[model samples]
Target: MAPIRTFIAAPSNLGLKPPAPGVAPGVRHLPEHLQQFSFASRAGAVQTIYLEPPTYHGDIDPETRMRNADAIRGYSIVLAEQVQDTVRAGRQAIVLGGDCSILLGCMLGLRSQGNYGLFFLDGHTDYMWPEHSATGGVAGMDLALVTGNGHEKLTDIHHCRPYVPEQQVFCCGNRVPDESYVQLIRQSQINYYDLDALRRFGLPATAVQFLQLVETRGLDGFWVHLDVDVLHNDLMPCVDSPQPGGLSYAELRSVLLPLLSAPACKGIDITILDPTLDPDGRYASVFVDHLTGILQDAATAVL
Candidate 1:
């Protein structure tokens, strides 16, 4: 079988916590965790180039939470370079993240290539506005920043306004959106499906519908931003903010495999899994195996 290049990078440095010296609180030894699993061998994937930058910069300035986005953007540029090179080489990217905030860099890197949609699969909507983001938690306003609805620092990266446009983006599997943000969601043009809506449509139907939309819009391709918190709290409680209901591991696997296998899915970012919470490393192992399984399955199809 031909080698399936997976350009993996770690950008787990910009969350809600204060800056530390190493991996920070929520993300510690992620790349090492995956390395031990030997998942690349199991999945028939070649991690051509793994970019793991040691950073401890998730803190938002207490006095400048809302204004700190530019600072974070500067930090993101480091990882963005790795992401850009990986994609430009025509390889699929598998980003092992520190937090959902790393998403800004990944999308920015892809935007440099051409227009691509975003598949935001998370437990929370992460659609908070800047004025509402006094705490300066980039993870909370992830979707908002990408849509050019937040402060200029994050929105105008490389002058790529609205890094991922609302029209080409589809957010699914989010069960929680702060009460105040619901109205904003309703007003946006981006196609969003909450957990309830996904359940009603069913995962298979939802996957099919999403792919159709990608095709209909004629987007260059699409990138996936996966916050493992989207999994059931009982199953994946290692994330920062735990939500109650989510897709069971099996359900997410079934849904995600199809999407990843699709030709237009250029890359993916997996975030929000904290090893400190899973002292035994069981969760990280399972998560790695699950993702690798999907890639192996996709590789098998072509083989």
Candidate 2:
């Protein structure tokens, strides 16, 4: 097989979690998480870029329980530049994120390429508005912001609001969503599939549905977002917010392997897993093996 054009981006975790109650997340350890992921030797990756985060990572203001929007914007600017370079070079950008908040930067990068879609593989809806978000962590509101539902600082970054249109975006593997999110999605076109539905219909059917959307929409390509919290707590529990039920490694591979192989699947970002929680590297290794295995297979299939 020929070389798979993959650029691995490692960003800081300052953009990790929201200030939800009892959610003292450690997203800052993402660099460590990337270091331990032995994928370069196995996944056939070509290049890796270490994007630097600003000094003011986590919030200093406890009242807001979040960093200033200016800081968030700063980090995204740098992150976006990196992603843009990766896309412009016609390579796949595998962004190892600071948090889901950096998803904004990823979409902005893809927008530079063309009209792209998103396959949000996460546990939570992440569709809350800033006012409704209890803890001001942008992670909680990144999806809402990107979809043009929140404040301008994030939504209008690079003046690319509604980063991916609702019709082209799909939020799958969801196990948790607040009432507000439920109501919003009910009236919207964003495709959503909860864990129960995924289990019942299975990944093969789900992948076909996703591909059909791409074909019908005539999308330029699609980007994927994998928040590790989507994995079951027992199999992978080092994330900032650990929900009880989720997809196991085998289950995730079943869904991911097919999606990654699609030519229209342009890029991907993996987020929410924290290395600090896993002292023994047990969960971290699981994350790497599944990701690399699927990536390798995808590259091989295309070759």
Candidate 3:
């Protein structure tokens, strides 16, 4: 069995300021700019590396925001280089994200070894490219960028055309997706388990179905991207984008437990927690507890 080598790649600049007021004071000392989880307790099972994003205060012009986006992309490039080195040494990579856009670097790291499948869990379909995104947030364009459909610097990371192909990618728990993004998803042939469909078929069953698909494809392995926004905003209110009718915390645990128990799964990225919104660390504490359990279970299975 191999050790679970978890790397904490924190992309702090990509986080949106907490919508709720008066919470920023609590998180002023955290270097990553977010109060995600403390890796101190899991220190034995993981090798943590904390990578910082370029500094950017959210109050800026669109041009400045775009420049900040470029800086983030650069940070991700450096992250990719480091991750490539880690994987080359036969370790699994777990990226603790500042935002979903960090997927670009993780995918590049995995792609350097060989192509891998992706299991994207989010409240929205992040398929919008630069041309299609109305908000122009790089996080919205990340999935498209990784699959070779967005901005040049992002798509061209790690000397690869795209990190993963459309057929090999699957998105689950999307309740709200832009119409144009839906059209792109349809044309690209990416598998999607929309919120309605997931509800209709319970999460455990859906996990089984998805695992069957992976088995059928004979994929190298699949990376799991767990965006906290996939959970109901009541349970996870700290994200940049909060959507209604998302999965319950228990439902998320159900889905992840089985997936992590499987040996074929490789790597994970947990994203979208903005601690500034969590006034008393309530949301962050719940998320951290769940994640700690997931990592522990996965490590135990391997051991």
lDDT comparing candidate 2 with the true structure: 0.74
Question: How high a TM-score does candidate 3 get?
Answer: 0.85
TM-score of 1: 0.89
Model 1, global lDDT: 0.75
User: lDDT of each model, Cα atoms only?
Assistant: 0.75, 0.74, 0.69
Report lDDT (Cα) of residue 48, candidate 3: 69
Q: Which portions of model 2 miss their true places by more than 4 Å?
A: 1-3, 16-25, 60-66, 177-181
Error of 2 at 233 (Å): 0.4
Candidate order (TM-score): 2, 1, 3
User: Tens digits of per-residue lDDT for model 3 on 1-303?
Assistant: 534575665655453443344332222223243334565355223576778676654332354233246666687787777677766765667777677777888888778877678888988778876567555566677777788886566788656968988888878888885565578776777787888887788888877777777789877667788888899888887777777768877888788877766666767777777656776777776767776677677666641
Expressed as tens digits, the lDDT of each residue in 1-303 for candidate 1 is 433567565745455555345445656456566667885566554664555554555545544355245556775676677778877777777777767778888888888888888888999888886567655678778888888886677878878887888988778888765666566776898888888888888886777777888888787788888998999998888878787879988888777877787877777888878777887888878888788887777655541
Indicate the worst ten consecutive residues by lDDT in candidate 2. Answer: 56-65
Backbone collisions counted per model = 1, 0, 0
Q: Which 10-residue window in model 1 sums to the lowest lDDT?
A: 59-68
Angstrom error at residue 277, model 1: 0.6
TM-score of 2: 0.90
